[model samples]
Target: MNKYILNKQQKLTTEKIRNLADSIGIDALGFADASEFTGYTIRNSRRRDPKLSLPEAETIIVAGFYIGGLTLPAWSNFLYGRTSRLYLSGFFLDVVKPLESIAAFLREKGYHAVVCDSSDSERSVLPLKRAAVRAGLGWQGKNSLLLSKKYGSFMALGGIITDAVLEHNTEEEPDRCGSCSRCQEACPLHALEQPHVLKRDTCLSNFLQIEYFPENAQSVSENRVGDCEICQDVCPWNRKHLENPLKTHMTALFQQKIHYWEDIFYLPNLIKMTEEEYESIFKDLNTGIPYSIFHRNVFLAMERAKKS
Candidate 1:
């Protein structure tokens, strides 16, 4: 086949992938060249180069799932230990399924494909936020989260590394977070002192994942038992989402059982919950919190509740 014919065929295949992603309910999609990321330091060379993840990688398919509806104001009662929208919506694990479907489609087309791990950034082969920006999905916000005009920081990102020569997004999303400092100021631990950067050591969201949080984390983690989204909550781009959040297929299902979740996550009830009950309630979701650590967080929240 001639080079022109081969290029046209690749473009057609890329279109098919986009349609499939939409049909599968990916809220946002973008394609980027699988090249070494040089705009920032990733420390890990393997993560900075897509070729390391998939030797023949020529394109990266980035997908975003909106979970704004899950972050709505109703779930913030101090009497209950709360989890982030990202957590309650099961996005950590839910994102893998759609990306895998896309990967499978590429593999069937005689292309090598790899789906990045969705549970943690460290586990992911690509620096997903940077890749998302290059893919034109969004720009990095002051809080170090991907921020889109529509979705803000309410997106759960996932992607597939593929050897297919897909049509790449020519333009990167320009930084729209100009002059916005709300996310930095909103951080209880001042983790975002540097714009578009985060100090993971002082980040409350990071602390919650570990067994022991510091003394300062106690006061700020008043009602939170899992992840924290205060920085995201204060982003000006997220104001619309906060006012009228968008509902995804996954979050819509979670909404139906909000009351049930509220009952179970009530700080007092969580403090008294047995191991079996904990497993039953959280088994399907990919929340990383163990029963013991979860109970400890609940105790901390209950202590703050008493003070309040």
Candidate 2:
């Protein structure tokens, strides 16, 4: 094919992919030059190199799905940690699955495609938040989260890397968090050091999600079992959208009522279960968070309750 014809075909294919993503409920979709993120570092020594995940990657297609901001209210319910799990589960179904489908579609078209989820821990996978920003989907908020003007910071991100040289969207979202420090002040553990900078070690959410709680975090690791949303909750962007009523249409699988931390920790079967058994019960909550970590958090919450 002539160079001009090839370029036109590629643009058409890219548009088709974007249209398909929108049809599948992806709130935002954009293509970024994979090479632009070749040396993007997320933090200390964590560089985002697309080539690591997909050697043939030429373009990165980033997508975002709105995870309704209203879910925060339910997260405030200390007795049941259902909101975060529900949001994550929905993210897999809504964001990850669609990205996988997009990759499959690209592969069917004879392009080398690889899907990357936000939960992926592999070093090769570029940070989806940065990729999204590069694609003009949103900007990184003060809380270190991708904040979209349309969806705020409540959106979940997923992406696909393909060798196809699609029409790219390089428009970057300018930082809109000018002089706002709500997230920094809201962190109970003082995790936010400054705008766009975070102390992961001191973050309660990080401690609760890991298998073993750090000795230094034992004091504040109580009452929360999994993800923490305090920083996002206090963000002006999130608060603006949360003013609307919550959309309770989403399903929560493990919604069994529990009045207190003891209700979860003292259950006869729960107390006697082996690590493997305990893991099986909460395995679906967040694949990134191991059952042992959650179990440990429960114990901490129980101890805190007892002391109080």
Candidate 3:
């Protein structure tokens, strides 16, 4: 059975919103109640309550954008520093535009709506993965990433908090990761020693985002310039997506400029790039990577390449 919580007059139906979302290129979407997350797992109040982000919030709309196709086979070559599919697709930040379009649609229908920037964890309105699970979009895998049956972990999540009451799924997707610890075993840093829980401090993805790379990071970082997907790569759920990826509307955009990226991401070319050159190439992408850190990673990747 589905649940529809009424807050104000229903200005829009789920059908209208779904149609708008489909037109806007959102791959997977679901709706959830805006009530505070009451559970032993999510302890942060800000992450729990959508009302904290938007006091008038009555519903949460979660959206996922597939990025599995962005993963390049050439990325594994140490001579060419690799970036996460999330970064390559610019979905880490560009995803806001699509979600904002949905928010705009709700506001046009006389409902208040605000988009949660998926890239900003500190100010994110709600727990996107948790909300996605509640909305029946997917379940949180042992890697702690929201895993869709179709897209796997190669999805970037975004959300909308609105006053509009919408029909939502009452049943959450049951945990499908029974006895699967591939993610835990694959994490080089042992960040996922505990199932469904990531130790952020030890995570290479988190480490690369920071200002200083640890001396020990070079050995494990391999050809990676920014972010890590070792856990996602080894998951059984992601095997099909990894093997035969699907394209989204953004695929055309990627194909158009991927040649430039292919040239620049080569470790030899990347190490010679000035901050201005880097800015010109990546500024519009909004990858959230500073040139200094990225350059350092490239130099390290070059050294690794030489060793190999």
Candidate 4:
């Protein structure tokens, strides 16, 4: 194929990939070539004790799906109170199915796309997510979330890295969060000191996701033990454009006033939460992600309730 014709096909292939992701339930999609971060990766690698960035990756495709919203039944009136691990709050399992499907599709099309794993894979997830932002899926929010001008931070990220020599797309998204302090103000533990950066010591999500909390963060478990949504919950951009099932599921967190401990703590019951009942709780439009994390969170919540 001639260079010009190949470039045209590459663009079409990019669009095809993006469309496939959407058709499979990805709420947001983006394309980025790994070459964009090579220099930074090298420089950072030299300075760190160990590095996670992959030097040879050529393209990183990022897709995000929604988790769900918070309704009157989901939150605790107490600043540090019990909040359940219902469907809306946990959908990590659902997003993975579509992600794997997309990756398989790309591989069948003759690309070696890799999904980075912070736990299982040698490559870093940050670079993958960073590559996603570079492809214009969203801007890096102060809270370290890739917040799309089109969708707030209420999305889960899935990534694919490939060596396909494709022509890069130049379209970039404008950071529409102009002077917005909602995310900064919403953090219960003060994680976001500035826009697009996070202080892990104070990040609630970090606190729950990590098994061992720092000595100073003994309060972390007593307080925000599960997932933290305060920052993303308050974004104006997230308040809009929630018509998409995934986006609506995520944006629903802020549309309520409620006082209740999480209703379900036992994991075994999830197998029975009816489709409507499950969707009403977690906001997951599809059953791709599982409720494992939420169940884990429930165990913690139940522990907290016991202590109280």
Instruction: Sort by TM-score, best first.
Output: 1, 3, 2, 4
List the candidate 2 regions with Cα displacement exceeding 4 Å. Answer: 1-6, 42-47, 69-74, 82-87, 90-95, 211-216, 245-281, 306-308
What TM-score does structure 4 among the candidates reach? 0.65
Off by over 4 Å in 3: 1-12, 39-45
lDDT of every predicted structure (CA atoms): 0.82, 0.66, 0.82, 0.55
TM-score of each: 0.93, 0.79, 0.93, 0.65
Query: In candidate 4, what are the lDDT values of residues 1-308, reduced to their tens digit?
Result: 11233477677777777778767767777765564455343344421111234455566676776544443332442223333222234443333556777678767887776665322223445453466667777777666677775556656676666766554545666666778788888776677876777787687666555555454544554434355566765777667533343335344443442222243323234334554664466554332333554445445555555566
Query: Per-residue lDDT of 3-100 in model 1, one digit per residue for the tens?
Result: 23247788789889989988998999998888889865755557788888888888888999888887534356788787887887676654676678
Candidate 3 local lDDT, 1-308, one digit each (tens): 44554444453467778888899888898988888887626576477788888898878899988888786667867788888888887776656777777788788888898788777565577788888998889899999999988889888888888988788768798888999888999888899999988888889988888876777765799889888999999999999877878867766567676677787788888889999998888887687788888787788888889999
How big is the positional error of residue 218 in model 4, measured in Å on the Cα after superposition? 5.7
Clashes in model 2: which pairs? none
Q: Which residues of candidate 4, in runs, are more than 4 Å off?
A: 1-5, 8-12, 36-56, 70-72, 77-96, 117-128, 211-224, 241-262, 266-308
User: How does residue 168 of candidate 2 score in lDDT?
Assistant: 74
Clashes of each: 0, 0, 0, 20
Which should have the higher TM-score, number 2 or number 4? 2
- The stretch of ten residues in a row with the least summed lDDT in candidate 2 is 249-258
